[model samples]
Target: MEINDLTAAESRVWRAFHKGEPVAFGEGEAENPATGSDWGPERTVRASVLRALLLSTPQVDGEIPRLRLSGARVTGQLNLMYAVVDHPLHLRYCHFEESPDFYGSRLRQLNLRSSVLPSVSLASTRIDGPLRMTDCRVRGPVKLAGSQIAGALFMDGADITTSDPSVPVIQLHQSVLSDGFAAPGLRVRGEIRLDGATVGGSVNLEGAELSNPGGNALRAQSLEVRADIRARRLRAEGGVDLRGARIAGRLDLMRSRLSNPGGMALRASSCVIGELWLFRSEPLEGTLHLRRSRIDVLSFEPEVAPGEVLFNNLTYTALTPHEPADRRLPLLERDGDGYVPYAYEQLAAAYRHVGDEGAARRVQLAKQRRHRATLPWLGRVWGHLQDTTVGYGFRPLRAAVWLLSLLAAGSIVYALHHPRPLKAAEAPEFNPVFYTLDLLLPVISFGQEGAFAPTGGYQFLSYALILTGWILATTVIAGVSRSVTRQ
Candidate 1:
């Protein structure tokens, strides 16, 4: 390779860097200024010289000297393997003739905004300042595995593509982004990972086009974001995984088209989010699992059909598509093949919060009916009996109704029939009320039913009342227990 000598700007920066002098390069330049003289012919700063400059350069005026080379054609590997330096190297509006290697290096800030570059490695590197790569195009992969970014990592409008389609275009697994990870309109040909990442601010991947077909397009499992996770208008060919992730703010998946037909498209199991907004985005294709996840507000639009999303044990304090009792009817109409009981319970609770007890009861009834469909005939029968008698251990009033009805019938039957005495010496004391009570309470004897020995139809009524009493008592106990446990 023919190596051209450093340009006048490069030479000036080189001298100032060595002398630890504060030389302002590209200060107040156009956002993306065009180069006139420092063009065409590339300059080569060898790996050895680049390493020496990074290691020896001292801070000028109590600040790490900024080496800004804007609109310059830079050609070099710029190898930084195992290099540890606290300095800022900004190459703004530049066109790189060669890629830089920053694997296992510790850099302060690396700003290469509005530049087109080849493959670069930032694996395990510690970038103290923001790694700003806005409006750039990467022809190769950008590796950032196990790396730590102290500030924000912005790649807005950057087109990142790679030759190897199997490999991820941008990887940030186990990386710590202290500020935020924003990539608006970032078009990547492969996967983008932030698994086990800890982001302090919002993660905005709005209008990003990530294509990793039949695989994870964006895997950020167990990611901790203090602010929102806004991925509106994201066109992901594969899927976006946020399983076990904790977002303090809203997880807005508005207008995002994610396709992972067979597998999980968006998994958020055990995730604790402030609000979950899936407005205008229907989960009609793949499974969106939110099992055991807790959110304060869950705003799913009317476009979202049931059975499209699996919400097993997902607890949300509030829900939207807000209307009255019949407002959530569209969601209830879903097939919900994988719907767990807690899903209905949560919905019922949401209705209850809005003081729509009738709607809540309807949800509970529907849940019980659907649950029974999966069970055997015997279970179905038992479920039906419990539902009718005590509203599936939710309404003790139903059990009370049954108890009162049985008592009334027994009293009327005994009042008409004057029963003979069981013992001649004992008077036939049949105060129809006390006598009925004695027969009704199988465990507790009230002494009236014992004194009277009813013949004919009254004898059968006594037996019927005892059985009804036992059933009602059992139902009431179950209902009370369930209420207590729920509380």
Candidate 2:
């Protein structure tokens, strides 16, 4: 406001503000008309404003003036904190010696494209319009915690960094954005935090580099995005945490590389989302935890290794049928240590809901096979025996086949040997077929096996037949019960 403190360029802007015309900092280019050695030239202007110029700057003819700092280098610390700025601040190809403080300020619009700055801290601020900082070079951290933006926020191809790379370079904790937040090809040296943030529009972070080795590269817990949150081709060195976040649209992580072995690359526990597309050429490395999450469609066509992702209690409503579930069965095929029966069951049910019974039964059968494989040596043998004998009590007719075989062997042996009859009183009356049936049927008291008195190997043979009959009967009963219960 003081005349003595105002530089030559600031004086021109002050005059322009009084006359209500378009205003800007620095100077415009001129022809080579002045030639003087005594007076040198100044390329960029340097000035400082102590007070807020909120109402003093008038709009000429009811039209806002452009404050273009085209190819200008702004000097000194611009303290516009908590100040209501209405005009559009467009600073292009400029350099700021000190970072501006815009805390809790209501700005109409702000543009800092292709510029360099120390840092940008707009915590708890409210912006009424768009914020464009494309391809800018920010040296320090950019913090926008608890801020609200009415329009889109763009930082595409921007080079944002800090001295310490471990710290979060871009923070938007608990902020709300009316439009999309895009940052394609952004190279940030540290983590990007969007914890508890809500975006009404989509968020596109394609080809962005988020690196914070061994820690979270992007912590967006409980974030609610109304639209899609796409990060295709994202190369995250550290892990990306999205625990309990909800996305209305697709969560497409196709071709993205997230690596954090033995730890979570992306922990999305209990998140409710739409279709999840993860079809990638390279195998997804790390533990992708999706426990208790519900997704409409799961397109996991990646070549994931065992223990690479933990799908404990993950449930999906639908599965996109890109190929037959046979070839795509590898998604559920994991190592013995990482086998989850419920997860398999959930997938099977999803397949069944889509009327793909073949795929459903395949998943169920796989669950059984993998489960048996994970057991001890004795258990696997028992399972195999049950499967062959009665099909794990799923096929009761197998028991009848064993019984008939036993009967035939007994009759053949008796007919060929012509063993002594049961009483020896009526040897001719004793029928070999009747005798075999008596030994085989435990419930029927035919009086042949009881009355018969045989010695040597024949006596042992009768006892074996009785034991075999009893075992077969028990197996049949079990098989019936199992079949009914499954139905």
Candidate 3:
């Protein structure tokens, strides 16, 4: 029904709503209006009155059982600023031809369940209550700058298309996004921004297609989040940037595809991340920088395609010697295969930071060998070991263990072979007459067996044993040293 066809009473109600005033209609009050057709004008007036009331009040209690604005076309803006309501704002299958601004509007408590908005704009809107826009289609730009949302903002099976290429489909600037902001299986034609924003909860943009020809598909700058930022199966034709971001929780970008000619950066400068979970992500062509960042854990799929991943001056806080030895070496090896030296370099730095110079030297030597160049002077000891003919698996404690065992074995052999017998023939002439010189001599001889022995046979055996022990000790030491140095 057009605005001109309404009766005098209906016209008055519509004008009051357009002027931003509160209006209420009782049960069947529209059935007997003073002007126009009783049912037609009555229903129109009733709907207008309810819409105005909802827009004006801070909260709406009680229920208007059956109010319908189905398939209605709003020609002008539908501003719902600072309005709170307990009842649902049901506007299913509605169309807005022009821009409908809902800036600074607060929904205290109510679910926007299954509401359809073909085209709408909500810049700087605050929703303190639960909101659900399942199966909604937004054709225009959805600006959400400097907004504070308390409850869950779900947009399941939604489509956010951009009418203009220059405008972003979902713009979130310096906003506090708590709870969940999900848009699974959605198609977004323009870019999505969460720049300088803080998210207290998770953001799931799974199976979403973000395509922007001239702009970044997903850009999040200096973003801080408490929960995970999951974007699995997301396809971005443009680049994805998360520079200077911090995630206290996990970052799951599994099975996603990011392609851009300008390059995509996931830099986390001076930021602390919990876990970088990138499993089965497609071959990314851009650089992933994590300089001066701290990560508790990092995981990646071994079979995934190679990409340029850089980790310079990064600190792995959760790396411990007691952790499974097999888990510590794979990332470095894979990084070596991918032609990225920063991984090995950063691992070496981690060892050096923890006062493990031996391990650090080993890592440096490995890098030198992989690159086939002369190692630095500080890595000479490790470099010499790496060039040895025999290769052993890299381990630092193995050398110490082998050296101690050889020493213990040699001592036992020396003690077992040498034996001295006591004699009483030559005794000290006047020394108490109790202590005999023969007994003293035997004790002294036993104490200095190999040192003072005059017989060549004993000396030869002692030397042979010493040589053999030295050979074994040197061999084991060499193996361990080489293993660590080769990287």
Error in Å for residue 298 of model 3: 1.3
lDDT of 2 by residue, 142-168 (tens): 889998999989999898878887668
Q: Which ranking of candidates, highest lDDT first? A: 1, 2, 3
Which whole-number lDDT from 0 to 100 does residue 119 have in model 3? 52
Residue 242, candidate 3: alpha-carbon lDDT: 77
Candidate number achieving the greatest lDDT relative to the actual structure? 1
Clash totals for all models, in order?
0, 1, 0
Instruction: Estimate the TM-score of every prediction.
Output: 0.74, 0.80, 0.61
Off by over 4 Å in 3: 1-51, 55-70, 81-88, 109-119, 265-270, 302-305, 317-342, 345-364, 370-487
Error of 2 at 277 (Å): 1.2
Cα misplacement distance, residue 362 of candidate 3 (Å): 7.6
The 10-residue segment with the lowest total lDDT in model 3 = 431-440
Clashing pairs in 2: 422-452
Tens digits of lDDT, candidate 3, 1-487: 4557665655654554433343333332222112222224333333444445455433323423222333333334566655444334544443444455567776553333233344554556677755565566677677777877787777767777777878768787688877768778778888888888888888788898888754688888788888888888988888777777888887777888777654553445567788776667886655566666788875555333244555556667534432232344454554413444766666666666666766666765566566543447666554555444222234435544543554455445445543332332432222211112112222223223322332356456546544544444454566666546645
Query: Which should have the higher lDDT, number 1 or number 3?
Result: 1
| Total colliding residue pairs, candidate 1 | 0
Tens digit of per-residue lDDT, candidate 1, span 1-487: 1113545555566666644454333432463433422544333234445555677655556544556656555556678888887768776666555678899998889887877778788999998889998877788888888888899999999989888878888888888888998889989988888788899899988998888888888888888999998988888888788888999999988887877788777778899999988878755357677878999999876555334666777899988866554556445445244546777888889988887777777777677777888899999988888888888766777777777787788788778886787786876556888888887776788778778888877788777888777766776677677556655
